[model samples]
Target chain A: MTSSSVPKRSRSAMDASAAATQALYGASDPGLRIRSIVFRSALLLSMTVALIAIIGIISWAVVEGGQRLSLGLLTNNPSSFRPETAGYRPAILGSFQIIAGVIALIIPLGVGAALYLEQFANKQRWYNRAIELNIQNLAGVPSIVFGILGLAFIVRGPLDMGFIAAAGSATIALLVLPTVILASREAIKAVPPSLLEGAMALGVTRWQAVWKMVLPAAAPGMLTGIILAVARAIGEAAPLLLVGAATFVTFDPNFWEGGYSALPVMIYQYAGRPQDEFHVLAAAGVLVMLGLVVVVNSVAVWLRAKYERTW
Target chain B: MKELGKEKLMAESASTKEEVFSLDGVNVYYGDSLAVKDVSFPIYKNEITSLIGPSGCGKSTILRSLNRMNDLIPGARVEGDLQYHGADIYGSDIDPVQVRKIIGMVFQKPNPFPKSIYENVAFGPQTLGMKGNLDDIVEEALVGAALWDEVKDRLKDNAFGMSGGQQQRLCIARTIAVKPDVILMDEPCSALDPVSTYKIEDLMMKLKEDYTIVIVTHNMQQAARVADKTAFFTVSSNDEEGSRTGVLVEFDETGKIFSNPADQRTQDYVTGRFG
Candidate 1:
């Protein structure tokens, strides 16, 4: 009834309305557009800077030591007297043994600690809160502090494990243990709580539910963390120095006893030398260490992509 | 026709039916706050009891207490008597695991383990160490949930690959795999489409022949469609303290509650006037 009585807009009024609509949809503020562009460029610049630094180091190492990358570099033992024929057999073996020990130590201890904290510990309790805070703090502590701890407690004071590859392994394990635990806790926390409830609703005990459902679901993420932590342990030289990774270990290192020389430690030793040949050898060692870390990290990324649950 | 038959059966059994759960003056609390206060109701055996309410009305809390699922939450406590059969479910000697084995639950969301279809169903029977052929048990549970025909060809396929409704049905199959006497469904079809919801409703009707079901539903029509008895819950607020608590306003046969409710609040709720 009111529609018939309603007055229509004048021609000029309709034209002005169309003009206002045009103005509303025309363009964003120029200042806002410039601000967005600036923000994006800043992010791109930061990422490019990091990428360039990594590529620069890698390329420099290849240029300096490209010719020296041979089977002999892996086969022949290091010799200060003959840098031309020198290799890193003993150091490679030592690094392998130390890393093997580190893997054996960290996997069980770190995963168990993470499970206890994530699945069982009550956050309301003061002690559990304290433990959580302590772990986060430990991850931030310098790697060299763990070296000092390993030297004082493990090498000399309590366990009395002398200068051996086992000492180096234990030291490096301690250095990366916090990282493994933190990553594992994060992985466990990422698993949906609904899965746990679903399992428990079927009459399984909490432990059964965790072991059967939670662990398997979180396995890929936990493994990614473990692999990254192991990579970090492999590259450690500061902690191993205090734990007795000898500079010029001629023989292959034993796990429990005898002098050890990891790849990074050997690189550090060669880089410290005055001879130009040893410097080349050190650059070549850097390539080998970088290759090993790259391989381990690749496995972690592959495992994550292949198994991570989207739900 | 099916609805008429179900209603007829319900009316015939109204007098002779046994009570599966009897709650008297139950109060549920989370830490220092009382979430649900003085709720009393009876859930009959071999019947689908629907608890209908708006969000945050403690229907889910009361449902979780049936199988002691709330024990998983720290500082959550239940007071007063909740009797399952003749025994107190929260007795000092009663084990929560055992309680859950007999009274399984299906959650609001379909949460299947990241495993094969067969493995998801088999997990329950394997955990309980049930004496039977594992394959047969998995098949039976799947068939019971009305999913065997669709999933039989892909028993080994991962459960996550299925559609959302299929996944929810798989969850239901998982619950029934251990042969529980009672199943608590917490809005099992809330995440499903209309067709899937109808499929589940039909499945629930068939399941009540063997297992008792108590469902918490937000959909009033769903409660009227499949539930034999309906319990209406509403949130009550204290003006002085500004604290909200869920209270059971009415409980009766589904038809009566929807058609002619006793309480004004239940009338308001069922007619979509207020919640």
Candidate 2:
């Protein structure tokens, strides 16, 4: 640790090496420059590959379905006898109702669970760890598995609310609940410890500190999570199938009382039909779903940019 | 000259001896491992007492225990008497939330809420349900922290907009807004530049006129410059566990501790020979 033991010539030794390197190559090393160029191009190539795939899919959907996408697509319900006039109006309304219900149910429950785990739970305890691990594992389970569970419990057995949009909503809510909880916990955990300590030092109770400081600090992240979960819920057709999302509902959906067909379920029904017109209609439904997903994700990004705390 | 130094020390010590906090045989632990063992000291009313030491010395840990902030950490426990106003802070009847209000804390880094400067200060008083002209309270606390002149023009601006020094002062303003009796500062200047550190040091001197302050600092010069009394801590090796525990090496008037420390460890640390 002494200066005497660290020879003064060590600096000169480093300088000499630097001078020798500079002499060998005047300003820059050609090998390093070539390596940097190669690395940069590799990264650029990877990005282009992903961009090409997305652009390819979107262009194909637009070209194939653009003719069928009209105002009538938004207003007219599906008709079995009239192939040209059949539309996804009921399916769109059904998707919205189901997503709205899912959002309403998930936000409070997911955020509450996250707050408990991050701010209140004693993480060292085995039960809390068990809950944490199970939530993570549940997020990875297939959506159709949730659908089966929903059919057994929600559609027929315990709750027994059969074939209603609310039942389908409940099923999707269960399917995405784990995703919301995991994302929310990450968001809540992102809040700085100093903010909590600052509030506590002001004589604010623990709950007050979390509510007033932590939750607000974490709001932008939670919003992003909710948006992503809703996106996933709207796109899932497999779960809706078992949870009683009817394939050919003609009426405008009622969430609490009637049969419903979501956009994906309608698309599925159309795609499986052995007719050229129905396939075009299915592509048009995909276009609508894609637009909705993009709009939701864009709103998430905007909300995050607006409300994100620098600290 | 020596006699003058001794007489001055005696006068300062005697005049400020009205005790605010008294600790006897205090031992702190995290889980089963000891952090600081058997620390005893008396902090006086309206005087600045500093805890100074190297890293892992538990000076900050002891400072936190005074306000029961240690309870926030899992498996952290405090043993022995840590008395605030003659009441055991660890007693069942005492609430940590209430105790925190009486003894406020400022952390090592400036951590302002992601709010306007005015709201940051107002938040504390609002939580306590103090009935008053909130505007006046906010203004008074900001002025007391010496930040009103700079931020008075933009009370509505987000606190993140301020410089690091201003932000730290805002934290002080926020702490004072609740009208706490004592303030605990944990390395308030470690993240600040020299000028900001000097300004904060000056503010602490002015603040001690109204509230008792206990600060933990790694910068020894800061301790010598602003603290009236200084307690030096050092890490002692625990042979059995191969762990180092913080132990109080010396406590005395800052001038005396710097010039004529009673313990060799304290002298070595202060003189920069060893820690």
Candidate 3:
């Protein structure tokens, strides 16, 4: 009978242990229900902490940033060391110009490379496998290394185009291209095989099916990936620093000319000056850049939500 | 419409039942594995030929072999003569894409593209570049599939919104819209309800007036019910790494095949003796 009651006995034994432990600390004697509430409360507390950290950071930035945000802040170039004396206009313009250049560079190269890897190239061949391996490795390689490569190749060594905006754009674009290609490949591959077969069975040619049907269906997710890649490019500081983003240029620089500064580099320069005014100016610049990235990423997220396929 | 009427009138002559295609000593290989061995069969104009067999018996293989749908499978190689109206279909220069344009197919599951209902029927005709009256052609195809009355009000609605039977019929409409000479079906009714199956069965009888259809089914009664002719396929294996090689065990008029079969295997299968 005792052996048959093993499950009940063990359960009671656990309750006895609880009671014994309760006797050792008299005030801690709560029911299972109360203990469960405490356990869940701990989990909820951790979640609240996470929420607080995120909201607190955003709130702090937004509050500190409110005073400096104006048309002058958005549209005028920087003077020096003073919050009233400085604006992110040049940096904002430079960021826009850099983003446009990177987009132009990425679309054709990234999508074409992805298409070649997925559709045209035979994955079974060793050379193709080597090429695939190289791309994956390139995706993981640090952005600073890409900057070094860009400086040696594009800025001075072979091409020697000087410290131009085009050079900075190209360097950042190259840094993010592998990410675009990798993401686009995943989006393209995620299209159902049944969909491909359906198209093929309809007498549409393979190229027609891929272009007209498959590409359109997969485009939204791929665009989302492109947006994230562009976001990463804008936030990147190491590569742009080496590629020559100027610290305090008053006028808009051409793609061919000297010293172009972007948002991050401008913020870095102000933050390093060690004056209270410069620190406030740096925070304002940080807010502006964060806002721009949020707007851009919001657009991408909107597009993804609008066109996302259930299948 | 007039041309279709004339074609129908001409086909009324039984002597006009010319051979649409012929396969001579045909062998199908998927990579190194042989799927069909030394198979030969003739397809007649405007006939419903049902291929029946057990699972993995290559009934679908024989159906796909007719239009080279098997070419979609990488490393699939077909040897020996497969002829379409006395032309060498497997010749190096002959494009399988072109062969496919002339022969459409409906799959087991009713696979409609995730598009509007009107777009689904229009897809094939658009690809084939049919000239003049796109709206008319779409309507005719839908009506021919016996789906126009049900779907006429909501041509702009999504294809997936329709019932399973409607989707299958839409697939049929898509196939006929291309004006292909033949249509191959692979277990099309397997995913259908009994009522939908009957409707499609009736649709098949009407479609045979214009298109040559070759179907594969596991249901013996379906073969007995709708087919004008029947082909029985079977597979055999030995001890040493034996591959599945489908053989045409019997072929005859549908009524004859069901009522009085010449092959022992055919009788066993039809009478539900064993797979």
Inter-residue clash pairs, candidate 1: none
Error of 3 at A239 (Å): 1.2
Candidate 3 lDDT at B202 equals 93
Output the TM-score of candidate 3: 0.86
Candidate 1: which docking quality band? Answer: medium
TM-score of the A chain in candidate 2: the value is 0.89
Which segments of candidate 2 are over 4 A away from where they belong? Answer: A1-52, B1-16
The better-scoring model by lDDT among 1 and 3 is 1
lDDT tens digits, residues A1-311, model 3? 55566698797898899899888887554597798999999999999999999788677767776677777887777877456767887777788888889999998899888878876787768898898889999999999998898899989898897778888989999999999999999988988766766777777887877777778778887898899899988888788888889557888867678788889988888888867777777778878878878988998999988988876
Q: Looking at model 3 chain B, report the run of 10 residues with the lowest lDDT sum.
A: B1-10
Model 1: per-residue lDDT, tens digit, A177-248? Answer: 999999999999999999999999999999999999999888899999999999998898888899899558
- Give the residue spans of candidate 3 off by over 4 A: A1-60, A63-66, A156-160, B1-14
Considering only chain A, what is the TM-score of each predicted structure?
A: 0.91, 0.89, 0.81
Mark the regions of model 1 whose C-alpha exceeds 4 Å error after superposition: A1-24, B1-15
Q: How high is the TM-score of chain B in model 2?
A: 0.94
Chain B TM-score against the true chain B, candidate 1: 0.94
Docking verdict class for candidate 2:
medium
| CAPRI-style quality class for the chain A–B interface of candidate 3 | acceptable
Best by lDDT: 1
The 10-residue segment of model 1 chain B with minimum total lDDT is: B1-10
By TM-score, the better pick of 1 and 2 is 1
